[model samples]
Target: MDNNRLPQETLERVTEETDNLMANYNKYVEQLKESYTNAQKERKEFLSSGIEFTKLIESEETEEKILTVYESYKKLLDDRTSLSKNFLSEINSLLSLVDQQLLLLESSYEPKFGIQTQNPRIFKTNKNNPKRLRNPEDADGPQMNGKYCICNGPAYGDMIACDAFHIEIPWFHMECMGLFSAPRGNWLCPNCRPSE
Candidate 1:
């Protein structure tokens, strides 16, 4: 009887799905670049308007004209700030969606791998020197967020890592992770907990 366990077709689908995912990632990257360009343009506009506002404030002009210029300058600044915040929120949402996708991809193969396979070479490495770090650029990126927390909410306070596993991605919030005390040594999240 087929019990919805990892089907043979699941493995086959992984290859195709990965290709599709790559294409989507490339498209999203282009969108990210456009957002960056727009941000730079907005920054320039803000700078120019700020200079104009400064000049207006310094000029020995009528009070009405000064107040009008100040009002317009404030509005422009607020609009730019709001747009920037919205753009950042969209980027964060995209990041969270990608994380969810990765988790789905991993779950699709868990039945076959038995969730205990020690040979998951998720990190690429040099064959000659096995001890060397697999991803040198990982350290340069932003710290991992609690996107995968069991609570499914934004992480609050300081985040911590598990020593039992390499923190390729953080899985919990400091307090929300349910750990009573800070781990002294190796610790594992529920997903990675060894079945004894």
Candidate 2:
């Protein structure tokens, strides 16, 4: 039974899939850029009309007409904002799918190190950290999302250790990550939970 965890073959698949996803994402971004360019051109055309909508707004005689033009411009701005959000959400969903697939692949794998075992590291969520720190919202990066414990206390997802997304649950440390693979939200400290 292939568990579909992060086996070498699975890694290869992830690499391929991630590459394709990135390509598609890039294509969408290019289209978005094109949309921005078109918007700029449209703005230029509006200006070139020489109607001077700004002047029209100040003149009571054409205030209503000027307001109409302003509303149209506001609509375009709103549309662009909405389009950007949709594009971001689309890419985010694709990345999230890949993340889940990797988790499955990692679980299916049984390391050859004689100690064939399920994940032993279990993390608890420590909501206290965020409440204590007055730092920016990034304080809640994935590394800091786990419970309070020895490994999970500090040194979460710095470059010297695991990346934010790859950190083991609970503790989010390097050693535990090697031993018992971490589930998405559960992870024990490497010191507390030794790998087989």
Candidate 3:
């Protein structure tokens, strides 16, 4: 397997799953809003009917009307409870899925961001050499005196000098090139590597 592909794959999967989770969350929110609206409407209707029943206390139909209203209210309460339970269950399940996805992302986080998880190799460079003078006329932009590497960074830490004789900025940070230690043999920078 290619070293680069794993992080890319994990990133794609996480993005897809996040999109799905957002869609599901939006759907759940809409359902909750509709349920709340319906519940409020039912409660208002129930309250108005109760008030009307007070005026009908002297009529013979009062008992039967009150019984009907009571049953309807009870059914509304049961429906609301059921809806709440289902919503909570779904939210819990979604949360669990999110947690799992987070764990997966954490595992691949370093590689995905090109961060080195292992400790960098500590090595010493020769300190006796004098800094080189920059040539303004150089084709690769104004060369910085004493600065080396593709990053144009100052010489410090673990660095490998390219063996290519004609190369400019021969010194390269091993970390910049994802190297743990200096190569056992002559090393070539990307630009100087011969075409395969």
Candidate 4:
């Protein structure tokens, strides 16, 4: 084994490989730490809260609102079930994210839209605002008149989900590109629907 006889190119290649290996090792270790901590916390909370949630399922429940919420979680779980095939490799990350969202819900945290499920939120509603057309029959249609779908009140726009002040018709966010002229395009906030 004559080190001096080794090709200069070969030595350079080994040095480069070593550096790459160290970088990758550092990245993997950081990722592992994050994964471990997040999983530990999420699993603990899920196991406890999920047990309570499950019990509510088996018992005779009368709260329609709670039942609806449970159903949404069931659906979310079902949608993400296929990811379980990847298990610890991928699904855990996604489940942790969903768990966080659910926890925020449990805390009744409101998004920027200020939507509260307990009380009806109204938008664009007033003598000057457009008339309401959120009835089941017109749900799939325009959803409202004068403005995009308010989800509940006239011209409320999508922000009506929680009560808040809103301009009548053509509620446009300046930063948002292009004018929204249909059934509250995808950018419209569903939570913004006026409930009052």
Candidate 5:
């Protein structure tokens, strides 16, 4: 795939989806904050009312006033409990949505840069023409028929076989020649090139 030009539609769709998810996530966070604030406020109210009821009992206030204060305190406590339950339920929903969004994002981008494997190629080896021996003293000797490449290296990595009919050491490593990929049409090794 060309790095310069990715599929524009896919990029745009992923961006738009991510933005939408983020917006929803932020909204949920705001709701959780509001729920927490409301719960705290209810708790404070319940605590204050309990303090008032204790003061009324200690002062030997009228029975009717004491009962009224106690009832109000109980109602505040119930409201606090309900608010807590609602906060927990909203938290669960937010977590579930986050998990789903993660899954969606993973699935969306997996196909773009997923691991891919090519079937290995099996080549037939010739026992009669085994690999040439690599010895320091042999470097000065005449070129061996079994040896290959200008560097006299074994056939490994990316190499291009010369198309010339009567070329010596026909195979050349693409790296040694500073080539990123194979050239178009027939290619000749340095030894086979005609004089300028």
Candidate 6:
């Protein structure tokens, strides 16, 4: 065999080995590409499914729905609270006005009518004679004579004289004369009434 020329069988074996290596590398590359394509398809499917699931969760009634409902009703709740507070304030103002009026009435007038006694069975009557006529010789003047009344004699406090009856003895205490209501028109005591 010549030194510069390779043997035919050895060349053929080397060429066949190189061809086999290239075929095996091409097969590995094809498998890697197929695997990459499959991974991409799986990723797409996962992403699409995730989006659909998120949409379904959002559409369902959950915390978001509750939040929306709370937002809508918050104004009504605040309005009701304000109205109740205003109503209570008005009622309190009216109560204060009524209390002030009551205080004024108590300070302005003193109660004088409806005298209560301990004994319910005892009837009130004068101890001395009420209709006794003063002697003309003993009489001092008309003013001194008219100072006393038939009922509750001897007018000590405020007194009023009746113009209708008892022209002789007309002065009487307003409370003792049973003039509870305001003194209007001519008033006459019970002792001076004309006998029916």
C-alpha RMSD for every candidate: 17.1, 14.2, 15.9, 24.2, 18.9, 47.6
Give the runs in model 6 whose Cα sits over 4 Å from its true position.
Answer: 1-65, 110-196
The candidate, 3 or 4, that scores higher on TM-score is 3
Q: Which pairs clash in model 1? A: none
How much lDDT does candidate 6 score? 0.48
- All candidates' lDDT scores? 0.50, 0.51, 0.61, 0.42, 0.54, 0.48
- Residues 1-196 of candidate 5 have per-residue lDDT tens digits of 4433344544665567567656666766676676567656656665676577666655545555546655655665566566567656756765665555445444434221111111011111222444443553442222234575678765455556677888656556667667676677667777887879
Poorest 10 consecutive residues of model 4 by lDDT?
A: 111-120
lDDT per residue as tens, model 4, 1-196: 3434434544455566556656655665565566556556555655656567666765434344445555655554554443334333443554455455444443443322222232223322233334444453533222334454332233323232322345343343211323333234233343455456
Which residue runs does candidate 5 get wrong by more than 4 Å? Answer: 1-6, 56-196
Q: What TM-score goes with each of the models?
A: 0.33, 0.42, 0.39, 0.27, 0.29, 0.25
TM-score of 2: 0.42
Error of 6 at 77 (Å): 1.8
* Pairs in clash, predicted candidate 6: none
Summarize candidate 3's per-residue lDDT along 7-31 as a digit string, tens digits.
Answer: 5776677677667767766776776
Which should have the higher TM-score, number 1 or number 4?
Answer: 1
lDDT of 5: 0.54
lDDT for residue 48 in candidate 1, whole number 0-100:
63
Best by TM-score: 2
lDDT of 1: 0.50
Better of 1 and 3 by lDDT: 3
